[model samples]
Target: MKAFDWQLQKNGYIPMSGQIVDASLVSAPKQRNTEVEKEAIKAGKTGREIWPNEPNKAAQKDMDARWTLKMGGKIRYRSDGTSLPQIALPVFGYKSHIAVDRRFGFIRESALTSAVQADGRMLPRLVTTGNTSSGVWADSAYRSQKNETGLALRMLVSRIHRRKPAGKPMPHNIVRANAAKSAIRAHVEHVFAHQKNRFGLFIRTIGIARAMAKLILANIAYNFDRLVFHQRA
Candidate 1:
């Protein structure tokens, strides 16, 4: 699938415009663990090694999957304008980090890792200097001083959303900058939404290898569908 995408780029079919980076959680079935078992595992009495010893029980547990929490999109407001507690839902599975071309919304690069992995840590692998020379747009999750320095090293403009300091509202200039960056970064979400909604891009597979294969195929399929739509239009 990656080879095909690269061929398209090599043939000048897909433009290498600025790239937008983002990640989405692909939920896997929650691994069932009893309270006692959970405590045993935490205390090091039981470990992943037990799974290999019991194939039947191991089948119920996804050895490769990990748990992570995803934040609710909006903060609920009460009648008096007090914000309700933000809910973070437990999701077990993997994260799909993708770089999409800004011009055609094609998936240019991708990396899959456990859901618990930090999105920023995978940015260097998902993005490349060759394609991102123009710029790279991403949300706050991908922002950090280290990432800013890395971007500068690659000679790429950092359009990542700035993180406001703790306990203080963002300065007006930074807020406006984020708004402008979001206008361009939001296009990346369209590819993810199409895959999730139209193609049902969810991981039913157990291991990282299977999950990654599924996501890569889906990305290739999405690029083909996008190409067809553009040609038709």
Candidate 2:
């Protein structure tokens, strides 16, 4: 596949997506729920069936075909860099656009949205990827000078249209205003990590759009889970 060049505008966003499923619904032959794994070990049914195998037929097929649709991308680290791998599940897939508060792990504003791209769109998603209600932030992968010129122009137009009230400042000042809006909107990484670490869930699908949907659902579920747990405690 041909790779495309991307850039991160001073103001960009990173949209996130995920999925949630019942532990019993995944079809892996060696599937072992952590709860089941412990019980089976106690019953002397202990085997490698509980944990995932790299070469198992079920694992390989699921990994290739359904993982992304079911699970969604998970963050991982390698010798080279970090990767978002798939996690499998049943029923729902969620795609969310979040903007975070840079000074804290709070979400400023977010839209629970859906994606139309199989591999997903580069700019629309990234430019809106944050929990901030103000501006956006993203990496170089989301921005490009050539292919995304139209989108860039659109964003510029939108920014201009949303410019501050009259008797305020000039365009450059508004640019700086947008930049400042993004200043407190840089905490998405920690939010992503919290979602991953707390849920122990990640992407597991091969279909890109389905995977994106799965991701969105997970975030919604995570928030609800926290609310419920915190209330009881």
Candidate 3:
């Protein structure tokens, strides 16, 4: 994938525009385990260690898959037109993180983790210096003093969206600014939408290593499709 990206640069498909970083959960079959077994898994014990007597059973169990609360699905409403609050649902599987170029919309970098991982921590790993623009865009979840500092250290401009002040109505200026940022940040969503809807991406594997390989292949396929589109244009 790195080689192909480099070749794209040589061929004038460089990611001159800034990059957008985000992650999405790829669903997998939920594991059925007892409380004790779940505790052991949470403690970082291997499947063989937890189920030492049942090698066949251990081989079938996916110890790496995890549970995470997916926030903000469809908004429901009451009969009177009042809207209900968004609910967070538990989703079990892996998380795929990708850095997409704003200009060409190629998946330049990707990482995979258990569904429980934090999206904020993965931001730095996905950013690359190859982009001509230094600006970075992401949702408020990626906003923090640490990330802001990190971006500054890397000489990258921080265009990450900010959250509203807690318990207070969002200031109009911030709401407007985030709205504009959303317009640009939204380009990355197309990549995820295409992969999930078109490639039917899901983790049917056992460990994070296998899951990572699966995500890498999906990203590569997405990039190839993106490249072809650019070529046709």
Best by TM-score: 3
Ranking by lDDT: 3, 1, 2
Model 3, span 142-185: residue lDDT tens: 99999999999999999999886655566789989998999999
Error of 1 at 161 (Å): 0.3
Clashing pairs in 1: none
The regions of model 2 sitting more than 4 angstroms off are 1-60, 63-121, 126-134, 156-185, 204-210, 223-233
What Cα-based lDDT does every candidate model obtain?
0.81, 0.37, 0.89
Q: How do all the candidates rank in terms of TM-score, highest first? A: 3, 1, 2
What TM-score quantifies how close candidate 1 is to the native fold?
0.87
Weakest ten-residue segment in model 3 by summed lDDT: 74-83
Regions of candidate 1 where Cα sits further than 4 Å from its true position: 35-48, 74-84
Q: How many residue pairs clash per model? A: 0, 48, 0
Root-mean-square deviation per candidate: 3.3, 16.9, 3.0
TM-score to true structure, per model: 0.87, 0.34, 0.94
